[model samples]
Target: MCGLRKVTLREPYPDSRPKMRGTVTGGADAPVRACDVRFGSADRPQFRLKTIQESALAGAFGQTVLKQGIEIRDGQGRPMDGSSSPTVAALRAKCADGPAVFIAEDRDPNSKHTFVRQIFASYVEAEAERLDCEPLHFRMATRM
Candidate 1:
């Protein structure tokens, strides 16, 4: 019932000109190109666990285990625990084996539900895969 979708984050400027390909030097008023931004909900265990009750993947592996935020396990399926606040570096160290599943909360503050956003095959490609759904890629623009 779940599907992947493409999302774009844009930074708008009323007074800016588009830049040509390979033209590094442009007028100061040139519109800045956007940068791609990618991340998974499971990137932060605390937040993931905090919002677990409101997630659809509640019955994914084990409800009890998931409720406790122990989705990242070892080869034998033992929960890995450390800091309540985990960083990208911490996740990379824990997910050294392969992809890991984590639910991502929707950006909409008013939404009452969250979905399984990404399945990371590795730390480098944080949003590489998905669970019971299609893959989604997001293009985000930033100011230069």
Candidate 2:
């Protein structure tokens, strides 16, 4: 038995990653997301309660559609004028060329407002860092 070695049930393999990782991305096309990572247990229960409330409201025809309720703001905390093309063009340049933060004039205007706030948040956050996530990469690259 001098040459024999025993393996235990809980021995972790050297190449295996732990259950948690330091960095993750919330890619739109992937099921794994940054929401799966967070600062605390804060959002989980709040989300469950919100889901229950939304479920109840669903039967009551839900809330009215938000029109003209969203405001776009800048780094100085002032509202951006959506009607000004020149101002928007400047924002596009400042946003590190992330997804068009504007409701593109060429794309259909329907339902796109639903995503406007979130897109701008990512746009601004990336702008501050001067980077964005793409696939497995943390750097921006020229489109193929």
Candidate 3:
């Protein structure tokens, strides 16, 4: 099954200056806010997947937010194919409970290497806390 492996956060883009601690700027497409959270390095490149809409995540926890639901996407920025893979199925099942934080190996479709994506529902932050890792909050610039 494709699962998430431990990963270290990417360093800030060379062009932009670092903002508040754990915050960086100028890495993602305009309008989408992103923050890089550092994780431990692994043999493969690992990525953290989060929804662009914070409200959707807040709503998942029963908090009031403008958005109502979460949308999961693949590395290619497409809707996930849950039915075709056990990894996706497990991820989907975990997400059903609430907002989820996933740590996954970034894969190239053209490559033959296989990897897994790990899903954590609320538990991720707790795990991070246990590991003494601070979760980085990146505020992506919104497109007008």
Runs in model 2 lying further than 4 Å from the true structure: 1-72, 75-106, 131-144
TM-score of candidate 1 to 2 decimals: 0.21
Give the residue spans of candidate 3 off by over 4 A: 1-48, 51-55, 58-98, 103-107, 117-144
Instruction: Give the winner by TM-score: 1 or 2.
Output: 2
Give the per-residue lDDT of model 2 (tens digit) for 55-123.
Answer: 222233211221132333454555543221211111222222332222211121322222222222333
Candidate 3, residues 1-144, lDDT tens digits: the string is: 012233222222223232212121343222123233222333332322333222254334321121122333444555431211212111222332333322322233432222221222232333333334334222111110
Deviation from native of the Cα of residue 98 in model 1, angstroms: 17
Best by lDDT: 3
- On the 0 to 100 scale, the lDDT of residue 35 in model 2 is 14
- Ranked by TM-score, top first: 3, 2, 1
lDDT of 1 by residue, 25-134 (tens): 34322222111122333232221211112122322434333333223443454443211111111111222223233332223333222212221222112323322222
Ranked by lDDT, the better of candidates 1 and 3 is 3
TM-score of 3: 0.24
lDDT of each: 0.24, 0.23, 0.27
